[model samples]
Target: MLSGRFRLLRREEPERANAAIGLDIEVFDAWTGQARAAGTLSGGEGFCAALALALGLSETVQAHAGARRIDTLLIDEGFGSLDEEALEMAMEVLAGLEAGNRLVGVISHVAELKARIPARLEVTPGLRGSTARFVIA
Candidate 1:
């Protein structure tokens, strides 16, 4: 996603050896120029990779087949791990999806996101219960 390459890994092991052996992805680190398993990625890197893959796959499926495009995407709380620049890039990607008439819902406690995203439903904890409020910019 971040100038990195995604290599799809097919099932390599025998079915009896590992039933869970399914498709996996190896992500190339832009800095190191080496591919590593997706499981080895940092939280922020993982989030970016996942977002990019989902968006790419959605576009590919809709363009190739007569399949319905994905209408919505919901991502929970992975923004905190990203740096300022990475966060900016991630927001730009999501914004592009929104521009395509797709509903992209992001749930995060990151303060920067509050400034970037306009309409939001925020939840604050209290003694009785969490207070929820709608904030629109």
Candidate 2:
């Protein structure tokens, strides 16, 4: 998921924390060229880093493959951690991807994200199970 300072990693090693699905990663360290506790990151920084990495990896794969051909990118809830500036930056990145055919899906409970990113699927929990409704707005 694209996040700024959400719990992307374990408490002890935040910098090393990664999405379980394995995407490209780029993190902005407060202390350059060094490692620190994962909890130390401000929300925006962490999310920016992760998003950058993911984007970079996608670019690399497309370059080698000679075409853009990823079916979709699904991100679970994690965007709320960012500040306004960070949120804008993240949105900018998402927006720029529109030129390609890849479908980028971000799953978030944060209302701001729901409003900012168009084309979404909402999941609601019920007594027996959960139901999802797809929306393109």
Model 1: per-residue Cα lDDT over 1-137, one tens digit each? 46444443443544466455446566656567776777898788888877777777778988888887779989988899997777888988889889989999999999989999999999999999999999999
- Model 2 C-alpha lDDT per residue in residues 1-137, reported as the tens digit of each score: 33333323323333345635232223334336544454465665656666765776777897899796766776665588887777787777777676566677787788887777667778999999999998777
Model 2: ten consecutive residues of lowest lDDT: 5-14
Best by lDDT: 1
Cα lDDT for residue 22, model 1?
49
lDDT of each: 0.79, 0.64
Q: Give the RMSD in angstroms, all C-alphas superposed, for model 2.
A: 7.2
lDDT of 1 at 54: 74
For each of the candidates, the C-alpha root-mean-square deviation to the true structure, in angstroms, is 2.8, 7.2
